[model samples]
Target: MERKIVKVGNSLGVIIPATYLEELGVTYKDTVDMEFNHDLQTLIIRNQKTKPNNKDHLEQVVKGIVDKYLKEKGL
Candidate 1:
């Protein structure tokens, strides 16, 4: 698909079709990755990389584990 870049206020931007946004679950203010294809001489726009979560469900899990330990050890 081809699109034309237009100027908005002080920034140049492209209008993405709503269908693609819905399919990707993208929303306004979401971060995007901009890459240049050196071989094809083109630009690739994608979702920004996400950081890995090292503490998934940590609060509840820690509470449960501590409670169980206290009961088992009679602390």
Candidate 2:
């Protein structure tokens, strides 16, 4: 889905749809972790409660970013 970036106070932000937030298991006032994959030109957001603080999880995130980059570049 395409969403427009709008000005929020002095910063820019996008309004995530309620359905998407529900799928992510997050809601207003809930904390989330966000990461920008510069190589893939992607923004990833994860529900903080579900975020795994482990080496394996970090490896998986990196692998996913690499895979997306490769797919986008048709490597």
Candidate 3:
């Protein structure tokens, strides 16, 4: 589905179809994570509350684990 960018108060925005939003299980006021793939020239969106499989999320989890371990070991 193609959508045209329209002026939204000053910034340009695209109006996402309600069907697509419903399929994504997201409604107004819900947060989403958006990433742009430079190579593919695409935009990817995911529900913020969902478990992320991205590298940044993985690094955060690892850092948390390491921090907890260091704290427990009093190091």
Which candidate has the highest lDDT of all? 2
Write one digit per residue (lDDT tens) for candidate 2, span 16-43: 9999899889988999999999999999
Root-mean-square deviation of candidate 3:
13.4
Runs off by more than 4 Å, candidate 2: 52-75
Clashing pairs in 2: none
Better model by lDDT: candidate 1 vs candidate 3:
3
lDDT of 3 by residue, 1-75 (tens): 889999989799999898878866899999988999999999988777775668987897799899999999999
The digit string of per-residue lDDT tens for model 1 on 42-64 reads 87666564432548646756887
Cα distance off (Å), candidate 2, residue 54? 7.8
Candidate 1 — which residues are off by over 4 angstroms?
49-75
Quantify all predictions' global Cα lDDT against the true fold: 0.76, 0.92, 0.87
The TM-score, computed over Cα atoms with residue i paired to residue i, of candidate 2 is 0.67
Q: Rank the candidates by lDDT, best first.
A: 2, 3, 1
Task: Give Cα distance to truth, residue 40, candidate 1, Å.
Answer: 0.8
Candidate 2: residue 36 lDDT (0-100) = 100
* Candidate 2, backbone clash total: 0
Consecutive 10-residue window with the lowest summed lDDT within model 2: 51-60
